[model samples]
Target: SLSDRLQGTFDKLRGKGRLTEDDINSAMREIRMALLEADVNYRVVKTFVSACKEKCMTSEVLDSLTPAQNVVMIVLDQLTKLLGSTESKLVLAQNRTPNVIMLVGLQGSGKTTAAAKLAYLLKGQGHSPLLAACDTHRPAAADQLQTLGNEISVPVFRGDGKDAVAVARDSIQEAVDHLNDIVIVDTAGRLQVDEEMMQEAVDIKSAVKPDQILMVVDAMTGQDIVNVVREFAERVDFDGVIMSKLDGDARGGGALSVREVTGKPIKFVSMGEKPDSLEVFHPDRMAKRILGMGDVYGIIEQAQKVADEKQVEDAERMLLEGFTMDDYLGQLQQIRKMGGLQKMIGMLPGGERMLQQAGNQADESQLTKVESIIRSMTKEERKKPKKINGQRRKRIAAGSGHTVQDVNQVLKQWDQMNKMMGKMRQMTQVSPKGKKKG
Candidate 1:
């Protein structure tokens, strides 16, 4: 995992007072290799590393903190920025009765599945959506949409013997008559983006005046996805993109390349085959996941959304005050309110890597044990772990259905961390006053 690898890279310099040029260079080298291994484009990685190195060169390292961690954060921020620092929403014309969304891609790009997923997503938000099956060429393509529509409880419009343009026209009229707010038109895809497919897609767009033309590409297709997106965008001038099969073990360079090539925002990501598996595209979260950094910023944003101002302020205060066991447990509850631990981690910088590592090391049983142990502690014991001695540890372990050794391990790790922070404080007080590090 990226976090474990990064943590290992900086483990030797954990208590160091400052970062030298050599430290930055060594860390950057490792990061560069990691990015390449993750299948990031070579040019993109080069540019990213150069920018990160420049920032690291000018960055001051905090006393008693690993310069490598600081560098990691810098790289994480840059990665987020490179991926487009915000979520991409589907564009809809304000005064338009029905928002026409045309989906285009090569054959087997999951266009039909994506269209149904989009409809399901829009319906969840209280918008009545209609699915248009413009793919009359492929065998059972319209039937596939009809099946998905039945599952999602949305209407699917299709016309036998009608061309793609005529199908789109009829679907838009049906959407308006039914008072549907959005129309998702799934077009026929070819093995390649040839002149015929291009012209047909353009004709449909011309007929319907689609508010958004989204190019769908399979993430597992690698760099070829970029070429397909470019060809489609050139022909029909798409408004956004949709990358499917992201749940698979794809390196995801295709996403970066497609975005770079088409200059269009990715509106949605299909993680699975299910109709509800579509997510509004968030570039920052994706980038952080790729870099092996947990999406800390994303967590904060979600926490702010669901939590009241006072609760959010309190959590922030606790985090700034050096989190304790009680605070940790409280945070767990708060995080649960927003989502589960795995989900929260997925939103963090290098989150995917951290979750992978954490999952490998500690199974669900371990998490259950940890939660139970925390629950058994008295309020005072949680706030002040120094109060937990041999007898208390034995009592807590027994109550939580764990062994004494398990309880001891948690305490030992916490104590070590406290000692390290203490050393960091001391180092800060003795170090030079003018420079503050990342």
Candidate 2:
């Protein structure tokens, strides 16, 4: 919603040929309101707005032919600055046999999941990571960590489920014995910040001397995140933050507040429930996404991860030729590999408007039905959807356990998609003079 609000403000600015002081002020006012409504810390919002206003008021922006674009760039810069300016990478101690990474946060802030996610990430990077279940205070916390570890194929070390400090300290030695290069310690958490919880975290830190301490914060914590982070900074002096549940429907105020409040960077974000969903945080890309410019690089990265060279070539060939149902189904599976349609749309510029134009085809829940319908078709029907007559449609609907209307709807959507691809191909074709073909 903050993204939508900000995009709307910029859209108004973009509509104008030039900007006046009044226009800049009006946009600033809207931005201020959007941030506040999104639950950004009042002081952070005030400071951010002031900085953006100062930058936008300059003649470089006011007198520019593309004043709106200039203002958007200025805002993007400031937002990136507010979100920690640069990427904060996880620092593991060099030459250390086993690097220790400690996770701390309030209860339900996703510390255990974050630990597993981080371990999974490290393991992918060729490090042998071991997870330590040090949250003896929480019921089944060790079991949960063990389950996640098993899913990731990483080892989990648990103590007697009585002394968290001992468990954390022993985890390092366990890593040494097994030749694990990194040990991620999942610390205990309280429902709220308290002296006892803080002291226990401090005690564990003293005992293990972790190479990096990541403070896990729920992205939905809103205004209270500032205070929670402040207390953690005062106590554990965390190295960076692991922002969890960023894929939730929260306004994302806590994520914006944490770095500014604690003078720390957000190292990673837990964007999904899967262990592989922990992503390295990039402030510039995030700022662009927030401003509705989209993260093209991020989309490319996701594509690279999911689609191989042949898959890409196949997709290109399908774009040139007509996309058969088989091609469409393969693309849908690739999208699923890249986090589903909703997520792919979220990474695109003006994605909301794009979804609006695409209608039900963009709905993630409809993907299952569409897949089922396509799968129910015979291979010949899939290769030549044009030959699917009334009887064939009825058969497909019955086979896919859907109404005939549903089958027809899927056919209509596929036709529309093919038409759109045709238009795109025509628009992108080069003429002899190197100009785009009409």
Model 1: per-residue Cα lDDT at residue 188: 90
For candidate 1, what is the TM-score? 0.76
| lDDT (CA) per prediction | 0.73, 0.84
TM-score each candidate: 0.76, 0.80
Q: How many pairs of residues collide in model 1?
A: 12
Question: Each candidate: RMSD to true structure?
Answer: 6.0, 6.3
Candidate 2 regions exceeding 4 Å error are: 309-333, 350-365, 368-438
lDDT of 1 by residue, 267-363 (tens): 7888888787787877866665565443434455667868887776655454335557876666656766664556654544344554565553434
Output the worst ten-in-a-row residue range by lDDT, candidate 1.
Answer: 429-438
Best by lDDT: 2
Best by TM-score: 2
